[model samples]
Target: MNPKNWQLSFFRREQRSLFGEILDWMLTPLLLLWPVSLALTWLVAQGLANKPFDRALIYNAQALAQLVKLSPDQQRVQFNLPQPASELLRADDADLVYYQVIGPKGEILGGDRDLPQPQEDEKLGSYEVKIRDDEMRSLEVRVAYTWVQLASDKSPVGMGPVLVQVAETREKRSVLATEIIKGVMLPQFAILPLAVLLVWLALVRGIKPLSELEERIRARKSDDLSPLDEKAVPLEVAPLVSSVNDLLGRLKDSIATQKRFLADAAHQLKTPLAGLRMQADLAQRKDASEEELKHSLKQIGRASVQATHTVNQLLSLARAEGGGAIDLQSCDMEALVSEVLHDSLPRAMDKGLDLGYDGVDTDSKRRFLKVQGNPTLLKEMIRNLVDNAIHYTPSTEERIGVITVRLLVDPYSQALAVQVEDNGPGIAAAERERIFEPFYRALGSNVDGSGLGLPIVREIAQRHGATVSVDVAHPGQTPPGACFTIRFARASNKFKTNMASGSADL
Candidate 1:
């Protein structure tokens, strides 16, 4: 292949495809999960921060309980909360603090009169509360309560049960919790973006080997089919690189084989071509006698025709081996047969041989006989078959050899068959198979032929996705001559429908 062709192939392979989709599928979820991780971290931080806030509230309540003192009458309680501590607790922007000392009968002793009391059986511990403010904003409040037993004093005032309840709005706790979260989350926020950037960079860096491999391949010479350096490739890409090297090895072998074949063919044809040219030149020489000139000229013409036929067959074989050098297109089998018959008619008349086509139209309308193939090659194939039949068939004044070309459409198998039958000396069963091979002339063949006609026909037919077979023209007895049958892929009804709808080009 040329450098330009290699570049084109590289470009075709590098064109975007499922690789992009797969990368997107793989990385999209990882990036998307970042936000989810952030959310989960925030929730965990809030839960941890609430623990310290609750502990602080409980500490404040326990300290307030210790400030309780009994009144002189022993029936009431007195409280002495320091001014600094009170101011500290009141400085919160949340709802005002409220406290109460309740007797055994649930009578409020000292505190806001409307303060809600705890449930009778509710355990003495720290708990959350919801309080409505003047402005109608529901405030989350924490309250700590404890039941204290007063010392019994046999005085006019009897000892009674006392309860101390301390409550504060959740504003200070919320502020503290926010501070704690900022202290922890600020660093993470700073690092998250950096981590993501690093991850992206790592992904690109990790795939660098693949990029390097691609560059190395692209930079290679077109004719260089040496295997890639597997040790330098990444483990993940080793399989792909190995596969490419294997393909290169096969292609190198194929190209070498084709070159060798071409060289051999040139060597084989050089001698015959040179002889034909020399013979023609000698026949045209001015010193030749009339008789000698006629003989030499006739021999030159025969040699020239033979050389032409050999070159044609060689080209056909080359095209077959090279896989489609000839451009293929849709061809009508029926029309191709008609054309072959028309061309062979003149030769048949000259030889006094009977040549004809056998087939019928449906309802007097031409049947569908189209096949996808090269028209020129099909014509060559038909010409070879018909010419062989005319040249080999025995012809006499009383009995003219008949060559029949029949077109059969096998709808069941969706194939088109062309059979060329002639009343010539039939081929022996053993020779039929070998006759289709190049340069394999049959034994006792009296006709002057280059032994390439059947091979050319077979090559052309094979190129068109068809098969050629030799069978007895007439069975049960020694047939009159050979019959060459060629089967080509027939156009489907869908193709015909497209043609009828003017959507098909041929």
Candidate 2:
């Protein structure tokens, strides 16, 4: 039970769609690659369309080369083709075909004269066909050309070589490439949308369980704090569900503690309030004597004082039950103990009990006496232990009850322990732990105490990471008495040897 605020604040965040995010991740790469696939397919189709058409242009050029032979005079190369053959060459619906042959002396031998010539740097072969892409009439065309030797034996003295060339328009090749593109790309256009639809359906199916879980949680009643079944959720989400279950368990325990505290406080306060009311009524009686009136007033004062003490104790316990961040320091544990003993001296004297302080000297071993904890809480814890000792120990003039607060230091570990020991009716072994529970008093103490002192001590000790334990102060004695020791974790540095000890009786 820590004693400060423990509230948490959560910032509101912008909401997002999980389904939309997942779908985008799955389909973005596919959509991005579609256009790239289309471009590559178009390039491949163009290559396929040109292969057979290019071969046909080479064949036409070879046929034209065969037509070259010696003229009748045998003076120079001549071209002679039948009208049917020439008409057959030009006959085409989609594309126009053209051919040209230049004699060895740069004379036009046969065929169309308007055809474009190959570049001068082009290699020449005798009846060997070659192909190139060139332009005629501002339109793109494929050209096949060759150089022809009129006679293998010899040519005319001034003659060198002859050139034969053939070209055709690109319309037919374009049409075939267009057809191939449609064959491959049309199906892809249709399937892209289908793929997107399937992705949407798959995402919807994947998160369906989460939606159902949300609905189940929403339908639960406010008081129904039962844990969610971790096994029912997906493996990835199980950790989240488990965390929520743990939080619910803690909340349930907190609610139960608050309820029990309220009930105990009410039960403990009712008796003193009733007594105060009775005493007040008696003091106002119509036929009361002076001595009776004085006695009633005294009783009223005692009851009122008891009521006030109960309220303060209730508030102290409530404060201990809350929690928040604590500022820790290496505090002088022995100093706090001495201060508490000094404060409780009057009460001990009033009850005729011997109150004293015994410990290592603060001036000599101040560093070794330090404990790491919140100073305020540490003081409160020591105050509660001393108050408990003063309240429970029986005192009388003949045999004075002795209550001592001792500060112990572990010479080897440097840890410190604060102990409150009383020579009075001791606590039974079975009820020792139970006595730390709020409002639980000893069975036959016959004391008018809040019973919150030991509980407060335990609470504060726990907050400081200290342990509290009770045992017999003096074994085998008629009144064995009780000793409460709080052992704190060592928080000091190197210790000094030969520590001085001190004690004072009050």
Candidate 3:
């Protein structure tokens, strides 16, 4: 194999499962959103962990603010805390706490001297606690601070405001946050795997029907062309199954056509083959007279001719049906009819028939009058129509057989039509369509024919996008003549509209 084809074949062999595709679509979003959910939960836990601790820090700062009292003479601000209140600072073993107080004149009053003052940008409310985060003693801590207004200004040591601040390390907040994270995230860790498992199981259940359908198709015998059960499948799959059923129905029709063609072919060939065998045996008889021998030879020749004609007709119909190499070339309808008439002259004359052409002048050769089609098939189609007319039309002492091959083009629409008319036993309207089937002869007709001529004509006409119709040529006469018309619609678009409007006589 060539490298390009080999590469293509190799690439096409790669397969993907529908179940796997569905699972990936379902679970990919879930898996991707899981980490997002975790980050949001952790952030929420941290905010929640800080709430109670911050409130406690605010209360301690307020308590220390109350302790800054005015002296008896309203001369100074002082800070004091009960000894029992001091132990509350170190109550929690996991975290260290610190507090500080500063006089307005920058004097250290009470508590740890290392506790930093609030930043200048801090909006400290009067005796209302405000909190911030800071580093104190080389450890991260939460701090709450408030400013107190001293009530004394008359004395020399008058103070403007006192600062009361409380600071605590973040060890307790970290533990609390860890606990919150555990409470919220632990369940999800377990649920995530279960969610994936449930998703996997759901996909398996969802696609189980396809698997069952495959098994049903596989279990059937090779020749079984029965349709899949559309009702049993899902609504989404019913349309696909319906399409498959339609294909199967067409296949069945095609197979039946082939079988019928074979049976009819065998039946049609049997008579001439048997005639040839009998004629040969008779000619070989030892007591056969000279006249008898001559007649046998004649019979043998007639049988062989009949056999050859039947086989050729059958092959022609088969080739037309098979659509073999129909390369289209433009040909004049009038010229083609003239050619078929010339070829069928001998046969028509033998029957004393007036086989003639009624069409446009050959010298004119108008461009619009010409048609596009396979020339060989077009001639074959015309020949069949002309032959049928000559074969069916009979001449007698009273009247001569008149067979006319007429070519017509609509003057306004330019649509082309070819008609073969004969004063023969015309076909009834009911049997006209049936006669187009292979080996289907008209009812009550004694003519010896392969019954494939009209069928071949119809097939070839169809290949060129034309329609064939058979109707009585002369109605209400002694023998209503048959007229076969082939209409080529591509002469112009207006032709279709004209034909529909019944404006064209053809």
Q: Model 1 lDDT vs. the true structure? A: 0.70
**lDDT per residue (tens digit) for residues 1-506 in model 3:** 89999889988956888888888888899989988988998888878989999999998888888888987777667677888889977688888899999888989989889887877777455797887899987999899998887655575434577888899999988889889989988999899899999998888888788888889999999778889999988898889889999988877766765676677679888999999999999999999999999999999999999999998887777667752457888887767777788889999899899887776554333555698888888999999988888887889979988988777676656668887888888888899899998788889888888899999999999989999977777767979888887888755656544333323343
Report the C-alpha displacement of residue 99, candidate 1, in angstroms: 6.6
lDDT of each: 0.70, 0.81, 0.82
TM-score of every prediction relative to native: 0.61, 0.76, 0.77
TM-score of 1: 0.61
Clashing pairs in 2: 2-322, 4-323
CA displacement after TM-score superposition, residue 335 of candidate 3 (Å): 8.3
- In model 2, how large is the Cα lDDT of residue 389? 82
Better of 1 and 2 by lDDT: 2
Candidate that scores best on lDDT: 3
Q: Candidate 2 regions off by >4 Å?
A: 1-14, 24-30, 51-92, 97-136, 142-168, 323-342, 352-372, 396-400, 411-414, 490-506
Residues 134-166, candidate 1, lDDT per residue (tens digit)? 211255556666766556465433355466766
Model 2, 265-327: lDDT tens digits are 899889988988898888889998899999988998898898888888777776676554578
